[model samples]
Target: MTKQRSDEPEVKPFKGPAGGWGSVRSLADILPREHLGPEAYRELARQNKPDGFMCVSCAWPKPADHHPAEFCEEGAKATAWELTRLRTTPEFFAEHTLAELRGWKDYDLEQHGRLTHPMRYDPGTDKYVAVSWDEAFDEIGRELKRLDPKSVVFYSSGRTSLEASYMYGLMARMFGNQNLPDSSNMCHESTSVGLKAALGVPVGTTQLKDFKETDAIFFFGQNVGSNAPRMLHDLRDCRKRGVEIVTFNPLKERGLERFTDPQNPVEMATLKETAISTQYHQLRAGSDIAAIIGICKFLIDWDDLAKADDDLPVLDHDFIAQHTKGFDEFAAAIRKTEWADIERETGLAREELEASARIYAKAKAVMAIYGMGITQHVKGVESVRMIVNLLLLRGNVGKPGAGPTPVRGHSNVQGQRTVGITEKTELVPVEKLEAQYGFKAPREKGLDTVETCRGVIDGSVRAVVGLGGNFLRAVPETGAMEEAWPRLDVSVQIATKLNRNHLFAGRVTYLLPCLGRIEQDVQASGPQAVSTEDSTSCIHGSRGKAKPASPYLLSEPAIVAGIAKRILDDNPKVDWDGWVADYSTIRDAIEDTYPAIFKDYNKRLFTPGGVWKGNKASERIWETPSKRAEFLTPGEISATGFKDADGRYRLITLRSNDQFNTTIYGYHDRFRGIKGTRDVLLMHETDIAAAGLAEGQIVALESDAGDGVQRRRDGMIVTPYDIPRGCLGAYYPEANVLIPVEHHAEKSHVPAAKSVPVRIRP
Candidate 1:
């Protein structure tokens, strides 16, 4: 919405590796700008500590032996940003009208600082006026009572803790709606769908310790440096142990190229960086399925040739026969796949796939790591299953340092799902919940993020209660949401900072400020500590040391309890007041619901470095219908059948170095050499030539989703870069407008943000 003040962004080649002094300088710059004092730095140091708060940035597991300063650059930025000395009070809202605030940039809105009090939208004045918490809750309760429970959508952000998410899910179900759409639906739903179908579990099989023993690692479409910087330390150690790291992505990511551990004094002082990836392959966008299938076909051919000579075959026949099903069909499918088709689909040579396969076959233990790049596609579920299939081929699932790992984005996103944040009632199981909590849970399947948006647009959804995320900005079809959100009967946002979503107020809107991760949450009994589960399934306690940003700010659990108490009124089955007083009761309830995984959840939560909830696949135990690991045969390599015209390109939405999800930290993307702008599109030189466009030329991107809907985003400057020939990259939230809401993954229903077909217009 805001035009660039300058002509174009300053783009230069960045030669240094990721992290090192660059990260150090970033942390220093953020602290001063955010006005974070020495106390804030001390609080940041407590991140990932045994009795400290969890970093709100990424979900990379905390190491057992962590340094005094275990946080990353992005973690430090998030800390300083959340604990900033600025505040947005009633006076600030009074000065800026809702109409005026709409013109401000996302970064500008967040920079105004934390929301200090409960505020309600005044449509008459077009300004938000401070309201009492009780009044806000009463109004929300009144609206919920008037509307049918099925008509209300409850959305949760990934940053919410397990206790809060559990309470939120329970409240929604008790209110008779399972319309619980979370941030995971937009990112890792594919992982859940594919992994469940293949490995009998939705989570990864390996832990953080497996990285040290891994012989080789295949990174498919994951940008670890900008996202999970803490993972760089593990990768560096793996490299030191002679582990081969292969990366496949559309663009050459600096994190995969090289990394300098900021914690290592020698490397920081000498400006030396560790070479991370042993091999980097620039595959075409949406070609992951094809390239992975190529690897499988190569391995199959190698095994066939070796078996013909009566020599030891490359296939792990003993493990396959003993622990898996459908391998014969899977192998047959791979054998029929042609190399010519693989090359055409992947934009890679036959030699490249074979070379990578050779490394993979030779490695005794392997781990495959991926992110949204692998999961945010039309065939994302199939792509994830292919990764699992590759691992299963070599008996990697039950072995040390071997398995599939889907690197999650949000800090507690995985934990949120583990604690019962889902649209499907079967995940929570109404019978078990009713037995444990004495309340009847909703049995019907509910709407996901995309469906929720559609429900809002169709007037079926009347009220929306957001726990912590900027849903309007994060989801696809931003323009459509901007139009539909105002039509809702009621909307409530329980957040720490002001985001664009707060501006998308319904007829009656309320903003309830909540405590940040670093703030002290004093309950009725005493100060409370919430728990978060990382990507590795390690459950740890996070106790905030800093004071609340504002006196009026309530803890997330308290906010959820307050709303639930008002809506449920004298319901004896739900003990909202008791759980809010002490979080351990909530943990006990979680243990009662999922006794197998969370056994002794309270006692183990206080243990040093927390406890690991064992994964079934890692122990050679599958819970599938066949009672064994299933080798799913994908129907075709090019399952999406997304064909780009001669001049069109496949555009993938990505976060910048200075941002996380929809929260903009700044306009610069240091890793990609972008500065002072989020309106530029990173394109290949050949693509620019074919499109008859030059670098710095402003253009519009029109979606070719083929659903007969015209979706376009204009005022984006094209920057020729090292991306693949037919692929383009742009910052998210800004580029989300080009992604059609209906164009989503099949089983998971996650929007195909990373594989949208688009045509450039000058």
Candidate 2:
């Protein structure tokens, strides 16, 4: 382990809810660092508005009645970080070599600010040199033409707008490749797969308005404060309205405990916060399936007892008979589940589980909200289905304030998948796509994020063209991906700022700077506003009011058009240039491709509060093969298999309050009371003592993945925290190396980032 610097940040316990004056102080301190002036606040006010640009942060839905300041702390940071005055010009790259830049931290690399010009890696000088956009595109096209189409992987991030993603996906198919992998494969792929299998739809059943009307809201495995701060407002309102909020997670998040809305001047001045989470249950990591099964079993027993006493039935028998199938089988399975096993697996007493079940059984309407914590496990898909089963037992679906909702991590991530950026053959049928576009779309499914990593290592994938995101840093097993990515023939990054991915240049690497979400995008026809779908499936227009960071920067649509024009020049059926001229042309194409959902794409997109592409399950119109919402029976839960030895603990990766996804805004995690550094492991006090480790002691963590490959990460300091026993918490990307790349969810193939078995070593 590396020696700790004497200037390491202090660590203490935070006693307040997530948002308060602390957020204000943090915003004030960060504005000047990014060279943002008073105008930045005005710019933030325009975000998520009908005429303003959408925030590129979390995917939380915008309120119907837009607030003067709709942006959260993380959104403000993301906006300021992109619109900063500091520029990473060609001259800046000339001063620093790739090796020198590789030595810097991820935070420092992006803090150097927006990329201002197109650059190509020069092996002779070991630095990136300036190049014209056309030359870069031509070189990329030439390299791509040399390789087989199957050998190329086209990756898209969630920050991309629907119009650009549509063009990108179309271009990939027209180029005769199905290897389209997006950031969703790493984050919310489980939500898509699990929900589709249960409810006949991939998206959430409820809208943002449902949160206000919900009688009870269950938060499973999500830390809303840091990941989606705007959600705190809804939870606070629910608390004020006497709605019950129940939380189940390994670690106690401040946002779930209490939240003082920054928008409330009275609460802000008085320092009074609204208490959230009427019942908080600290379950073990990866034990969600067990806990859910226990709750269901208890509900079934309570219902049976109610019927025996000639009282009102606890279960919705009529809804079950009319709208669902396989309930009898599912109920039988739940009945057979032992309460002792549930108590052992979930690390909770039987009485506690029954109490929670009673609260749920009493509610008229309930909303089950979850995040990556439930979806980033080995049984993530099954866990998600269990959540659906719980909701279905109570006839929550197709109701006003009740359904299953997976709080997506990135803005427009769900939208990207909706606009044909998917690897599933069933989701985007190749035959339909080929018939519509006059191109031979590949029938076979493409590689997902984990498969892409394996493809890169096996020399099957030769090139990677990323639309946006830090792919290498964001994925698991960073140490292995960092090595495998540079071995590719060509790599292209369409981004606004410098990230760690830029340093991992292949034989031929091109960095094409693109317009940020906050910048105006003027096409050949006129100024255009790209549309993005929120967490609630509301497609809203996003038009940038701020000027472009650099004149050399191109719109994502324009860049995709340029590459498509060069690669598929012989294909006359594809009108790449026309799509780039006006974003509406692309939206028209989207409507033509997915007419059932995207009808009236252009007209409805401009409507106030955007258009709601309604979910079938939300309307009791199941489109499954059975024509009914199905009750999925999940397998048994094994909660004791995570440990290899008595001292081994489960490690769950998480984000800090000062960070959003892979981007770090600062070193301070105000909610967790950590400052100055990210190299720390959060552990229970008893676990720290059991491992013979003291507070602030540097240690190494080695995973027990059982894949015969040794995965270890060092230089992690042990810090006492309120985490569950036999579980440890650490920041992602740093802890990602400890997670084996091969270990992922069964069906969705999303990396099991939240539950890794590891042993702490001195």
Candidate 3:
């Protein structure tokens, strides 16, 4: 492998199609780097199989007819990263001080490998010392009891299984605190808020089979190649079947143009690829609201023309009248929107939006797909609702192959939310919990990721318990979290691997090593199988066949139960001991809580590819107050993207081809032609020339929120690319420092990481 520093970014124009030899080379380099052998190869074959562990990366659904290699390049990387032979034991921590470790890059810190034992921070020595599980849990419980329950924050990452997520949330409720927050707050809170309001549900309405039957698939800011590579297979088949694909994004991402499936013998042998997008529209960053409104306006104008000429109506009048409400007002808002505003905001000509609308109107079924690009903005919630409005105009929802689907990040982030890991108490079944657990569940709303960090900064939050995530690095204003983390009285992290999150230890911190998904988790009854819900609402079992990574490692469920057992000692109704002994007890408890969703839990969950627990929106059963799909109008139809002023440009923080959310797989982004570096900026040639800057010029970035706060990052090399004018792109988590914590969505409070206004200084 080439030894390259992340600071020295090298750019080469990648002429290869997505996947093909590029993806093959990626796996080849990473397999040996992570020290994988024949045993790991066998485990890779079992991924996404009937009785095997789900891919530990994206939440993309598995097909009913599972292929031998169902995982993607990123999935293989995640599995290899997890199953690495190298270990980070107490001895590793004793050698490195927190001050020295903090100076290392995220990729360098992660390369230390999986954690092996439970350890606590030694403040005097500024190092971590190994501790027993009993001592760690006891001290955590004592700290919780000492502080006000509301002051402690309970957080989890999407890597947690559904069984563990449910228990984790319930344990916090049992402790008389409802301060539950997970990774969803940073990524898809907009989707949850927007979908619940527009469709009366907070989950994806489309299934895996929908891809086969859809007439058109509309891509919005979702980079499928880097994020969910396995999805390219279904898309390749869709292209062969003549399904029209329209894409609207800031960059001409390699994933949206063409893809050559590596697993397909015909494609690999023939050196051929499938064309993905029929119509590609490049728009300004955070301008989806204007683009969507323009499309709606065009459709509404076509409908009016049809009415006047006594011709066929363009809109789906029958579906609208029968299934939807507020059509007249929604039409009024669209009609009042001007073409000039849309043109200026979206950075597209009038013909581009009209062409997109014409294709949408002609298609019988359309699936609206999006990712964090649309969600991590100030108007993220409204932007999602606007897309739903577009789908409703043509009745592209509640059917087999159409609906709004947020390509959720993380393996079980959606499942975690489904099983009560939320700050909102209303989402949790308080009545059912009160009866089952024999405790009065708290109803007061708690702080989310944004508020939790503020609480820490203000000295209100006293304790934090994390189940498998680098929370300190994932949130916005990362510098604020890094400084505030130590202010907390106690902190606990249950994790499989060592990362940068542990370096910034609190006064009393515990890093409890847990079993990875690829390892066998045996209980008192027998071997245990944990379950997770995918992006499509399919629930299935994932059991590990390999030996445990370390003898000291505990399962996530065991760690949660251990902490609860220490804190809620007098709770008679809650059987912490039995649940820990047998995972079936936990499954039974989850079934009791949501009987309709998880009926015949054990038998159905073990089914191949899992059973689909359809959302209410798919069945056209509105759970909203009016019992109808509401077409509520957005408060503003104005520009959503920031207008370039005083030389300030919009910065779009994105993931590299080799990285997952906040987890660096490597320093190479193959799709973008970036090698061995992440600290590089992607800009348009026009913008670079307009700013009088040359390619390869080193520069620093400063946030331009006008709050008089100095937030900046030094040493960013500019590289001109195909991104839209007045917009620049950079890698996430690394650029998160430039964004203030308070800059979040108006409704969902998700950090506006995708579109932070910034100025570049050479």
User: Per-residue lDDT for 36-85 in model 2, tens only?
Assistant: 76667778988877777778998887766877788888888888988898
Residue 96 local lDDT, model 1? 90
Most accurate candidate by lDDT: 1
Please report how far candidate 2 places residue 495 from its true position, in Å: 0.8
Q: What TM-score, computed on C-alpha atoms, does each candidate reach? A: 0.98, 0.98, 0.98
Q: What is the lDDT of residue 513 in candidate 2?
A: 97
Task: Give a tens-digit lDDT track for model 3, residues 1-762.
Answer: 233366556798899899898888889988898887798999999898887889889999876798779888999999998898877888988898989989888887777788899999999999999988889988988877888989999999998998899899998888888888889999999999999988899987999889988999999989999999888888888999999999999988888899998888999989898999999999988898888898889999999999999999999999999889899998998889888878887899999999999989999999999998788888999888888999998898899889987999999999998889999988989899999978888888988999998898899999989998898888888777788888889888888877788888887899999998888999999999999999888987898888787899999999999998887757788888798889888889999999988898987777886888878899888787778888968666532334568698889998988888888988888888888688788899988988889998889999998778778888888898889888899998899999888888889989998889999987
Candidate models: Cα lDDT each: 0.89, 0.87, 0.87
**By summed lDDT, which 10 consecutive residues of candidate 2 come out lowest?**
1-10
How do all the candidates rank in terms of lDDT, highest first? 1, 3, 2
* Regions of model 1 farther than 4 Å from truth: 1-8, 639-641
- Measured by TM-score, how close is model 2 to the native structure? 0.98
